[model samples]
Target: MATDQELELIHDPAYVNAVRLAGKGKLPKEKAGNFGIGTEDTPIFPGMHEASALLVGGTLQAVDYVMTGKSQHALNLGGGLHHGFRGKASGFCIYNDSSVAIKYLQEKYHARVLYVDTDAHHGDGVQWSFYDDPEVCTLSIHETGRYLFPGTGNINERGQGKGYGYSFNIPVDAFTEDDSWLESYTTAFTEIVEFFKPDVILTQNGADSHYFDPLTHLSATMRIYREIPRLAHKLAHQYCEGRWVAVGGGGYDIWRVVPRAWSMLWMEMSSNPTPTGPLSPEWLDTWQPDSPVTLPQSWDDPEGIYEPIPRRPEITEKNTLTVEKLLYPIRSNQSSSVKPT
Candidate 1:
């Protein structure tokens, strides 16, 4: 498990102590709010610190395995608590595992890092942590904060000072279907990697953009999940020499959406054949009784799973423009630098 010092790499020391005390029911009630505890989103509970620290430890271990060449890629499904900040917790995330892991990558391995976040919610904590540092580049694609929580991640919130052009956000509109969602993701990720080639790539796979997830309004499907990892895997090999570390982020539909989405990630990372057709009857039978919603029987979502989006064309066009604007600087620089020899 991660020690107190490791968490302090990205969290305030006092806040770490507060989480420890609150986990034991020893922190004063009035002071808990100061550290973002005892709220509807992140309630105090027994072993909260231990639980959060363990997730950080898992991501750290994944980083070690990939950076040290023990493995080319690793996944920590419990480790993408991207909303946790230095002194405060939000959105049910504590300890900010991805932030700690990125800091660890820089300090321990001396590697340039590229952080890619695809959660429905903004990866606010991770983005803010390295907002001023150029060595760590963060790219987040999520639903537009105009209608979502932690309403930041606008197209213009690039980095500051030397970190300018290092931070990228593509906040797609609501009701965006699979084609439009993938278009934005593929375009931004492709260009960003070309712009900022790094020694390692860290991906936060939130899986909450799926239509089944109740927390967000994006209309993606299993298709994006399968393709997300495929591209990440290909890019890791192409640019980072196969060093990639993946961690879980926000996915509220635990029974249906998350499992299938994350399974595709693992399959792509490990080079396993993508599973198609029906899901195992034995597996479905085991969990179907407990699930309030009927579990999907196939790997891919069926046709017409939801009503056709009436404004799909508009949403797609808007997202396309957003991606173009976000990448204009990089594209401009690239084009301007190319001169006839």
Candidate 2:
């Protein structure tokens, strides 16, 4: 479990205490609104303090394994609660595990960290946590928060103070398909990793951008999920000497999307070949009855699973422009390196 001192790495002390009291019924529910508790998103449940701390603990343990050289890469599927703020919880997240882990990496190992977020919603809490810290560079690629929850993560929300240009956001348009989504992610990731050259990399892989997710509007397919980890794996080796920590986030379609997407991530981490063809009969039989939707038959989504999106050209063009803008600073630096004749 995460201790109060450890939690203070990112959360306020009073907010932490409030959660503890509220969990034990010492704090009144009516007063919990100020702390962002007892709401529809972050409901006040029994043992909430411990439950939240365990999520933090899972990510911290992943950090411990990587920092100690026990593992080159670590993953905690229960973590990546990036919407939790220093004093308040939102978006069903109580503690920002990635925020706390990034802070711990800086303090304990003195490592320069690169955080990549691919959740459908913006990672507002994590971005604001390290907004002015030069050592931590955060890159978030999400569906634009124009109408989404936590409404943030625009292209202009770079960094502040000494950390300017260190924080990058590329909010793609809704109805973004596999190719357009992957293009934004790959271009930004490649450029930023080369520019920052961080000592370690942490990725928040939220699978809610898929077409099946009920909460978000992005129309990404399983193809993007496969490529997401593939690029991260390759770059971690190239720049950070294989130091990578991955965590899960924002996958409400627990039956169909989350399992396959996350399984691919673990496969990439362990250097196993990506699976293809149909899923195991035993695996399907066990969960099929309880699943609300029909489980997929193969490792990849079938052809024509979603109808062709209308205005595809317009959406793709808009996303490409957003990526170019996000990478403008780096691109300009590259141009300056040309050295006039």
Candidate 3:
């Protein structure tokens, strides 16, 4: 479901060659700067293609597993390179793997797909790729591009003509807390899935947006991130007859954050809820063994999904009114008006 060999599919010949050149282990003066080939974030190390390919290959296999009905849902934690464009790469992604997978699904299985991204960063590459596409509905939630990298997923950037309104962007703020965030995401996703009703769901679950992530300032706990996979699974079962493909986008804290968040994701997909806050020994052995962070016996209990709906009606109304007032100008009925009864 994701890939780096998409040179023929999405990349310019020149840019693909540039990536290839960078892989050769030498660099021109601007090579490191322009290609992001050698930087603190995306160091152009040897086997760049291989490491990226592992992600892609794993994702593609997941797609097959889901398509074949072996599993109702599948996820690729290392996938979701949304920053890579058709002719160029940016934002730490060399190849737009999510787009590549979407195209593949269209071509091979003729599957109608809905791609939703909740990364702190906009899914610019994926959105732009499918801008004029009617078959794909792209929805994203993130800090408004004005404050983030690759700034593009504004509210009005809907798909064109037949694709109009099929695309939606809900940009929150850098400091937006969890309760408000998940409420918006759940509302939008529920509405969109009910309307478009695609054959499959492809979600970009990026842990980079979490509070612990070094890259983005957005605040999301492990529980919110964990809820995403669970929600994706539930939605797939509800709307798509249990067909789902998940791709990882931006989780940079390679040692501390990314693996734990993603492990919870895997647990969600597998329908096993491990006690939160402590990494299970089973998980630790898989992700780390030698390092000091050899995955804990159990993951620390996350704050847990925010209390979007208060237990009491009066309190729920109060929260709803607050959202209705603050978010009305921006989302209007799309969010605030849809308060749960």
Candidate 2 Cα lDDT to native: 0.93
Q: Write the per-residue lDDT of candidate 2 for residues 1-341, one digit (tens) a residue.
A: 88888899999999999999989988887779999998999988889999999989999999999989999999999999999999998989988999999999999999999999999989899999999998999999999888788889999988999988899998999999999999999999999999999999999999999999999998988898889999999999999999999999999898999999999999999999878889989999999999989999988999898899998999999999999988999999988998798
User: By TM-score, how accurate is candidate 1?
Assistant: 0.99
Q: What is the lDDT of residue 172 in candidate 1?
A: 93
TM-scores vs. true structure, each candidate = 0.99, 0.98, 0.79
Number of the candidate with higher lDDT, 1 or 3:
1
- What order do candidates take by TM-score, descending? 1, 2, 3
lDDT of 3 by residue, 1-341 (tens): 23444444566666666666667776574855665556655667675665665666677777788888898888877788888776666778877778878887787788989999988899998998888888998888887787788788877787787777677787766656567678867877877787678999999988777665677766666657767777888999999889999888888767666777787888888889834655556656766766554343445533443343333344334334533443334365456658887
* CA displacement after TM-score superposition, residue 19 of candidate 3 (Å): 1.7
| Candidate 1 per-residue lDDT over residues 5-86, each given as its tens digit | 8999999999999999999999998999998899999999999999999999999999999999999999999989999999
Candidate 3 or 1, higher TM-score: 1
lDDT (CA) for every model shown?
Answer: 0.94, 0.93, 0.73
Measured by lDDT, the strongest candidate is 1
> Candidate 3 — number of clashing residue pairs?
14
Error of 2 at 35 (Å): 0.9
